[model samples]
Target: MKTLLGSQDNWDVVENGHEEPVTTEGYTNAQLNALKVVRAKDKATLYLLYRAVDKSGFEKIANAKSSKEAWDILEKAKNGDERVKQVRLQTLRGEL
Candidate 1:
């Protein structure tokens, strides 16, 4: 007598044989974690920028008080501030 295997079992085997697909734009969990760390570093840079500016100026952007906020700030700065632009270039070059 022969035993029969279902399609679901065959699909499972195929899925198991392949590496898990990257969930976000080909980025794995480790890559995402690293990106989070980079965002945190960028946030620190924004904090430094806020310190350089006046208290009120700092508060205006401080509402975005997290890494994502800092990233947005950095993006804006890159467009308007020479220093920030340099930092952004360095970051893209993996030199920061």
Candidate 2:
């Protein structure tokens, strides 16, 4: 599993597991890379991943795609949607 730095709240597991005492540092590069890859393929996942990485990742993802698509992905992901998240995870794992 990958570990991210700069905020644990940006993780789906952390959110779902209701983990307490979120941290803002100490993430592995592999985890950060996975988060970036996930965000690139799905905006919703990107939003969640944002909580772990720097804001620059968000800007990059947003700039890489259309505003409409980015917003749509963020909205859907924020609403607890999982389809896109699953797809993003699969892509990150290179199982797609």
Candidate 3:
């Protein structure tokens, strides 16, 4: 996903922080563009995640404000897979 977004020039919205300063009155044009980019990217990510989620996870994350939040919630709701951990450990030990 990171590579896909980077190729499309939208990776910053998903993976990098927006560093543009905000004012009390409003945002500059560039800042506004950044905001729009982040919002659109977040919504796209959320939609993609939704399609791949189970009913229970969907219900739990339906109201998430952003894709990152939804992903964190979904992760927290899932059980830890010991088999996956063991595989990772085995791979690491092989590298030793």
Quantify all predictions' global Cα lDDT against the true fold. Answer: 0.50, 0.47, 0.69
lDDT of 1 by residue, 12-68 (tens): 221222223345597889987866655455445445546655665565567765534
lDDT for residue 60 in candidate 2, whole number 0-100 = 44
Q: Residues 25-87, candidate 3, lDDT per residue (tens digit)? A: 577789678677777777777777677677977898899877777766766666455667888
Question: By summed lDDT, which 10 consecutive residues of candidate 2 come out lowest?
Answer: 12-21
On a 0 to 100 scale, what is the lDDT of residue 55 in model 2?
A: 66
Alpha-carbon deviation at 83 in model 1, angstroms: 22
Order candidates by lDDT, high to low. 3, 1, 2
Query: Any runs in candidate 3 off by more than 4 Å, and if so which?
Result: 1-24, 80-96
Task: State the displacement of the C-alpha of residue 86, model 3, in Å, after optimal TM-score superposition.
Answer: 12
Q: What TM-score would you give candidate 2 relative to the actual structure? A: 0.22
Q: Which 10 residues in a row give candidate 1 its minimum summed lDDT?
A: 1-10
lDDT of 2: 0.47
Clashing pairs in 3: none
The candidate that wins on TM-score is 3
- Lowest-sum lDDT 10-residue window in model 3: 16-25
Candidates ranked, most accurate by TM-score first: 3, 1, 2
